[model samples]
Structure formats: structure tokens, C-alpha cells
Target: MAQETAQQAPTTAHTAPARALLPLILPAALVGVVASLVFVGVSTAAEQLQHVLWGPLPDALGVGRYSVLWMFVMLVATGFAVGLVVWKVPGHAGPDPATLGLDARTMPPVVLPGLVLATGLMLAGGPSLGPENPIIAVNVALAVWLGRRFLPRTPGALWPVLAEAATIGALFGTPLAAALVVSEALAGRPMRGRLWDNVFAPLTAGAFGAMTTTLVFHPTFDLGLPTLGHPHWQDLVAALVIASASAVLGMCAVYAFPYIHKAFLGLRHPMLMLPAGGLVLGALAALGGHLTLFKGLSEVGVLARDPEGWSAGQFATMAVVKLAALLVAASCGFRGGRIFPSVFVGTALGLCAHALVPAVQPALGVATGVLGILLAITRQGWVSLFTAAVLVASPAVLALLCIASLPAWLLVTGRPQMQLRDDGTPIR
Candidate 1:
């Protein structure tokens, strides 16, 4: 009997992690569904607002769609509206968006309304940022609040992980993306139990979140580039050059991010800072034309569909203008995330490279450009690599992109990230 007891103890130890997954399944699925629903609801509201603000309202005013003057006025108005919320609302829109991301400190439920309003206003007003950061914050806070009421035994930290997984999966339209981003985050941290134990719940949540978003919105991605059948040795060289140059450009922005945030914060009031920032962004949008406005998702498709149609100079102008928009929106009190804008800038850089050289394939150029820029901006190799691969939608170039990332990663590893200090100061 004593011998049997010893054997049973080892068996139980071996199966503990697997058994843990079974009980977590329901909670994980619920988190995924709830998180995705919140994201969809907010995004839908923003899209409707966008259509009205940029469409029917303009028609009522007898102006053309996205007219420069209307856009300028609307953007300024958005700034004031969001600033009012930040100044008057319960949570001050959670935190300054310039200093936040998926992995930031978790906020309370009281912050949700402010975050939603700020995100909606910024999205509707055509800020060069995405709903990622603000949306994630909202979902995370909601998940924690719900978990406390319904899942009394669950760890508080697990809710953040689940919320991040669900939101990232929904945003990227893939569970793999959430996995890559989270694993990259957890890679070097101290390990206490089996790694799969930590990964199982998040993966389950992310998968459901991705499926829910896909069924609801069906976001589009069409590059119109020729299929990349196979990679050549020359492709490697081109990728290296393009990616390196993009890394340098991204580093310039990264180093400058803190100073820009400080300057805007120095305004000392959202009332003053955001409207002024909006004016600057409006001027830039006017200079770069309509294509450089917005979060750059649909605009990226526009750029990718006709890489050869634009002159090198045109592409350069778009990249520069979008980069400036990203800086301003982040620093100037607008609520949004940096990833989408960085992707747009990267795509423009790749298109510019193809325009200049004509020898590099558009897919190779775009993928490598995105990889370098995202790596520098996020400082996460797995997320950057996955995003670049997914953007071009070409599996053939994956190997070359993987190789290209190494050099880019080396360039950005020790650099300052785009996040800010808690006191609104730049982290050096």
C-alpha cells in the first residue's frame, strides 16, 4: 500500500497541469466572448460616428467628403471633446495614451467610460492611431471587475493575461498573434510551474476572441501585389538594406518620442495641449493629403494596391506625414495605439523602396520594412515578425523575413522604447 501511494503521487503531479486546463475552460471562454463583444461594440459605435462625421454631416454642410477644411475643423472639435472628457470624467481616460500599451498597469472599472469616449472621438476624428491600447485597457478593467464577482477563486493577474489575449487576438484576427506577443513578453521571466500551464488559458481565450471578431466585422486586407512564389538570394540583400534603413528611421522616432511627449505635457492642460496638437496634425494632414490621415489601416491597403503608381517622392511624403501624425496623436492627448500607424509607415517605406529600385519584390520589401519598424517600436521580435509576415500575406517570404529580423533586432535591442514615465516624463 505504501508503494502504491508513492506511484500515485508522481502520477498526480504529472497530470496536474492538464487537469488545471479543464476547470479554466469556461472562464477563459467567457473572458474571450465578453472581451470581444466589448471591442466590437466600441468599434461599431466609432465607425458609425465616423460615417456621420465624415459623411452625412459634411453633406449637410454642402462640403465634399473628407474636405480639407471640414477635416481640419472636425479634428479640432474632436480634440476639445476628448479633452473635456479627460478633464471632467471620472477616470481621466485611464492614463495618458502616450505612455501605455497592452502590458501597462491595470486600471479600474471607473476608467472605462472615459477611455471609450476618448477612443471613439479619436477614431472618429481620424487620428493616426488605432483603438488597440484604449480598448485593451477597457476590457482588462472589465474582466477584472467581472472576475471578482463571478470568479472569486481566480488569481487577479490571470484576468489581465486573459484580457490581453482576447483583445490582441480580436485586433489581429488571430490567436497566434496573441500567443506570439504574450510569449515574447513572458519568455525571460522567472518560471514557477509548467509553461503550458500559463499559456493554455490565454490561448483558449484568444482563439475564441479571434473567431468572434472575424464573424462580426470581417476586416479586410488586400495588398494587390503579385504572389511571391519563392525567395531568391538577392531578396535577402534587399531585405537587409530596406530593413536596416527602416530601423534607423524607427530609432529616430523612438528617441524623439519622449521629448515630444514632454513638450505636449508641458502645456499643463488638456484644454490647451490637445487642441494645439490637433491643429498641428490638421496642418500635416492637409500637407500630405487625405491618404495620410486616419489610423492607416484602410490607407495601407490603398498604398499597397498600387505600389508602382506613386512616385518615390510621393511615397516619401506619405511616410513622413504619417510618422508625424503618429507622434502628434500620441503626445498631444489623443487616445490610441502606435502599432497600426507604424505598419502604415513601414508599408510606405517598402513601396518607396520598390519604386526607387524596381528590382525588389513588393512583398519582400514591405514585409522587411514592417518587421524592422515594428521591432524598433514595440521591441518585441516575435510580434514584429508575425505582424510583418501577416501584413504581406505571403508565406514564401517568411524565411527571409525571419533572417531580416535578426539584424533589425540587433539594432533596436538596447534602445529606449516608446513608452513614457508614470509622471508624464519620458523614460530615458
Candidate 2:
């Protein structure tokens, strides 16, 4: 009996090594492939849908002004989408934006279908949320789902971290940023060691996702400048001032968002509330002469590409009206993310700064304002800085923007307001 037992022990130990190796390699590889597929599929689908919808909708509405009837039609369409999400999907149609923080660890599989449907509806109906956040959610959810189905016996900690990181990598367009965000999300958790093993998965997933996205969507990274422009001494000083101001404004927006959303929730009916919000948005858009509506990035591009055409007053008006419209749209239950609106707002603020100080470069001010807002709202200083730098087509501006964002970060961190709770509650 003793010899038999000893023989069984060695056999068991030998099998354990093979089993362990299988779990590590197979599950990790599966996660990478699944996450990459989710990223590519969702990213391609969203962009194609956007182009198809936007092209015909505008022309069909006619070449003239956005009429009240058309505005109402859009409002009803948007409201219907929101109503479907709120009523149909589980977990109340995915994570509440007001409550999301820097944490991007493992989210549930439910987030995948919810995000895809919600994002598709919003984009189709012309609500202003960007596809990037939903893409992240979908990819992460897919990874988690794949991990669960294929590697159920594997250590739970290993698969989730790897899958999430890979999903982030695919969504962010930069694997390094995806890895950093995922690592940061895991910072306080007990699974730090396992997280190290998962790093390679995300990197691979991100590379695959990026390649697929580039092929399908053909996203443009170049903003048409020869390196981020250098900042003059005056431009540097102005950037500091603009960034500081943007930090304060961003905090205000963040704090107010939840309250606004809550207020809309109290309206009791999507049909009524949605049209009301649309009317308000339409009015605001008219106030800004149509430049403030329909996702402001194109307008921002126009401003950036041709700064000479817009005066300081126009920029300031556009900034104020766009901010107000965004607040109303979000508060009234429009399905969208705040990133693009924030970027548009930041660019307008930058243009306003340049108008006030002609000696300061417009590109530098744009970078500074964008970085400041991103720091205050997203708490993602590095990503914001990179975005600002890229948008301005100036490496020197990027450097200065990074430097200026420190004080902006300080201001944001010092605020006592709470943004979100773990269970997806938004605290105003």
C-alpha cells in the first residue's frame, strides 16, 4: 500500500505541471483572440454605421436650417432609443457614466450586449456619445465571457485581468495606454502578481485590435501639422492660465452632471423629457448657429484647420452654448459619452484664449485646455496630454501642455466632490 501511494503521488505531481501549463497558455491565448475580435468588430461596425446614418440624415432633412419639425423628430428618435435601453437591457443598460472612475478592471459580460446596442442606437439616432468607451466595455465583457466559458477551471484572477487589459489595449488605440490603465485599475487589488502574467495578453490583443481597426475604420491620427507647434513664451504663460481655468470648469461640469441626470430621471416619461431636451438643445445649437450640435468634433476640426475665420467672440459663444447644450443633452437622458463634448469645449476655450492674447499660439492653447479638462474629468493626465498634443500637431505644445496640466491635476484632486460608487451610483 505504501509503494502504491508513493507511485500515485509522483504521477499526480507530473500531471499537475502539464495541467498548469495548459491553463496558462491556452486561456491567455483565447482571451487575446476573443478580445481582439471584439475590438475590431465593434470598432468597424460603429464607424460604418455612423457614416451611413449621418450622411443621409442631414441631406434628407434638407440643406437649409434645422427646422423645428426635424428637431422634434430627432428628439423622439433619441428618446425612443433611451427608453428602450432603460426598459429592456439588464443592469439598466450598462454602467452609468457619472459613476465611472479610473478603474477599468473586470466588468460583467452583460456590459457587452448592452454597450453594443446602446452605442449603436445613440450613433444612429444622433445622440453625441463617442464609440470609444462602449468599445472598451464590449471588448472587456467579451474577454470576461470568453474566459468564463473556455477556462472555467482556471484561476479566476488570471483570466479577468488578462481579458480586461487586452480589451483596453484594443479600445485605446495605444496598447501602452491600455496596459497602464488596466494596471492602475488593479493597483489596490490583491491580484497584483497574477496581473503581471496577464500583461502579455493585453499587448497581443491590443496589437491585433489596432491592426484590425486601422484596416476597417481607417482612423486618422494626423491633425495636419508638422509636429506639435512650439510654444512662445507668451503662449506658455497663456497655456498655464487656460489650463487652470479649464480645470475649474471641468470640475464644475463633472460635479453637475450627476445632478442634471437625476433631474431628467425625475421627468417621469421619456417621450416628454426627450423632446424637451431636444428642443433645448436645438435652441442652444441655434444660439451658436448650428456649430454646437451633432457631436462638435467636426466643428472643432473646422476651427483648428481654419483658425483665421473665427473671432474670439464666436469661439467664446460656441464654448458657452456647447457646454450648456451638452449639459442639457446628458441631463435629459441622451445616450452618449462626454469625451468628445469635453474635447470640443476645451478647443473652443483654447481658441477664446488665443483670441484674447494674439501673441499666444492657438495650438498651444488648445493643447493646454484639452489636457486640463481631461485631467479634471477623466483623471487621465497622460492620455489627455497625448490627445492634446496630437490634436494641435505640435510636439512642443504637447510638452508645454503636459507641464501645464500638473497644476490642473492638483486642482482636480483637491476637489472634495465624489463622482461614482462601485455599484454604479452617481453622487453629485
Candidate 3:
């Protein structure tokens, strides 16, 4: 009887950790799914609005769908509209996006709706931004609110981790993306238990989020390049050169980011700053054409599909225009993220490289370009590497990309990053 009781005690002890982890895993998984749904809903609404304004409305009015004049007018109108919301909204739309990044402070539940509305407007009308930061902020706020309401015993810090992981998973349509990003983020932090233990709840949340997003959206970023047979010596050299050049180019923007942000802040009023920003964006759009507008995710596809069709001059112009648009959108209090626009800029630059030198593989050129630009912009090596490799949709080139990333990292390390100041001001 003594031996049997001892065995039973050990069995119960073994089960205790799993039982305790249930609360963490379950709530995080729930947050992941809910966050994915929220993102899908928000993006869908923006798409519909975009179709109405840029598609049906123009057709109904007997104007060309790609009319540059109309595009300028619409963008200016979008800027004014978003500015008005920021001026009068209950939460001031939860902070300027140019001053925010993936690691922003969690906002209150009351502010979530305002942020969502501003993001939708920015996305739907026209802005060189993506849904990443605002949507992540929304999920973080929602997750925290839900946790307080239902899982009072849960750790507070875990909420942001799970929220970030879930949203990243949803955004990229893969749990691996979130895992890599989280691992990189949490690598140096002191923690108890195994590293995987820290990652368990967040990875679980990310898996659910990715799966849910895939089911609903079925998004793809494949450029449909012919299968890369093997990495050639020339490919390595070319990738290094391309990535290094792109990094150098990106640094120019990084240096300019703070100054532009400060200039916009000097205006000190949404009425003045946002609308003026809108007009600047309008002029850029008129100059760069339709492909240079928007948050730039879909534009990458458009560029990739027909790289050969465009001349080197055209590609260079697009790259420059997109970079400028990203700067304006970010500095002008736009509600969006930097990743997608940065990716677009990189793609344009890569296409230019390929056009100038046909010997370079499109996949290789694009991957390295993206790697360099993302590194320079975000200052995160793993995220930059992952984004570059994933954009190519070819795992075979990852080894070459790893090699290319070394030079790229060297260029971007210690450079000014695209994050805002802690006191709700521009980082100078």
C-alpha cells in the first residue's frame, strides 16, 4: 500500500505541470484565432472599400481606373479624412504609426476601435503602409482585456507575447515566422525553465493563428520563378553586391527617417500635418503611378510577375518613389506598418539589379535585396533573413541568402532604426 501510494503521488506530480500549462496554452490559442479573425475582417473591409473607391466609383463616373489625377485626389482626400479622425477621435487613434513599431505599448480597449478605423482608412484609400502594427496593437489590447476578464490567473507579460506571436503568424501565414521572430526577440532575456518552455504558449498561439488565417485568406507571395537548380559562384558574388548596395541605399532612408519625422511633428496639428502629408503623397503617386501606391505587399507581386517588362530606369524610379512614399506615410502620422513598404522598395531595387545585369537570377537578386533593406529598416537580422527567403518561396536559396546576410548585417548594424521615441515623440 505504501509503494502504491508513492507511485500515485509521482503520477500526480508528473501531471501537475501539464495541468498548469493548460490555462496558458488554451487562452493563447483562443487569442490567436480571435486575432486572426479580426485581421481578416479588417483587411477584407479595407479591400472592399478600395474596390469601391478605386474601382467601381471611377468606372461609374466614366473615368479611367488608372487615372493619375483621380488617384491624387483620392489620396489627398484619404489623408484629410484620416487626419480628421485623429483630431477628433476619442483616443486620438491610439498614437502616430510613424512613431510605433512591432513593439509598441499596449493600448486600452477604448482606443482599439479608433485605431482600427484609422488603419482601415489608411489602407483603403492609399498609403505606403501595411496592416501589421495597428492590427497587432488591436490584438494586444483585445487579448489583455479578455485575459483580465476570463483568465485572471494568467501572467500579464505572456499576453503581449501571445498577441505578438499570433498576429505575426496570421500576417505571414506560418507559425515558423512567429517562432523565429519570437526566438530572436527573447534570446537574451532571462527566463526560468527551458527556452522552449518560454516559447510554448506563444508558438501554440501562432500555430492556431496561422492555420486560421490560411483557411480564410489563402494568401500567397510566390513569384513563380523557375526552379533554381543550384547556387552558382557567380550567384553568391552577385547576391553580396546586390544586398550590399541595397543596404547602403536603405541607410540613406534610415538617416532621413528621423529628420522627416521631426519635421512633420513640428507642424503639431493633424489638420496641418496629415493633409500636407496627403498632398505630398498625392504628388508622389502622380509621379510614381499606381504601382507605387498602397502598403506595397500586392505591388511586390505585380513587380515580380513582369520584371522583364519594365526598363531599368522605370524600376529605379519606382524604387525611389516607393521609398519616398514610405517616408511620407510614416512621418505624416499615417496608421500603418513599415515592413510591407520596405519589402516593396527592396523588390524594386532588386528588379533594377536584374535588369542591369541579366546574369543575376531574379530570385537571388530579390532575396538579397529584401534581406539588406529589411535589415537596414528593422534592424532585425532573423526577421530580415526570413522575409527575404520567404519572399522567394524557395528554400534552396536560403544557404546563399545566409551568406549574403552577413554583409547586409554589417551595413545595417548600429544604424538608426525606424522606431519612435518612448515619450510619444519622434526618435531623433
lDDT of 1 by residue, 159-216 (tens): 8889999888988888898888778777878655666667788998999898899999
Score each candidate by Cα lDDT. Answer: 0.85, 0.64, 0.86
| Every model: Cα RMSD to truth | 3.7, 7.5, 5.3
Scanning candidate 2 in windows of ten residues, the lowest lDDT window is: 11-20
Whole-structure CA lDDT of model 2: 0.64
Error of 2 at 206 (Å): 2.6
Of models 1 and 3, which has the larger lDDT?
Answer: 3
Best by lDDT: 3
How far residue 286's Cα lies from its native spot in candidate 2, in Å, is 2.4
Q: In terms of TM-score, how similar is model 1 to the real structure? A: 0.94
Q: Which segments of model 2 are wrong by more than 4 Å?
A: 1-54, 57-69, 89-92, 95-97, 101-114, 158-164, 186-199, 226-232, 269-275, 416-418, 422-428
Model 3 Cα lDDT, one tens digit per residue, 1-428:
99888888733212236666667778878989998999999999999999899998999889887788788788888988988889998998997776677875789888888889999999999889999999999999999888888888888888888999999999989888888888888877866656677778889989999999999999776777654558889998988998899888888888888788888889999988888898999889888889988989888998898879898899989988999999889888989988889999889888899899998888888888888888888887888888888888887789888998898888877666777674544343
- For residue 19, give model 2's deviation from the true position in Å: 14
TM-score, every prediction: 0.94, 0.80, 0.94
Quote the positional error of residue 318 for candidate 3 in Å. Answer: 0.6
Model 2: colliding residue pairs: 129-336, 129-337, 227-393, 227-394, 228-393, 228-394, 228-395, 229-394
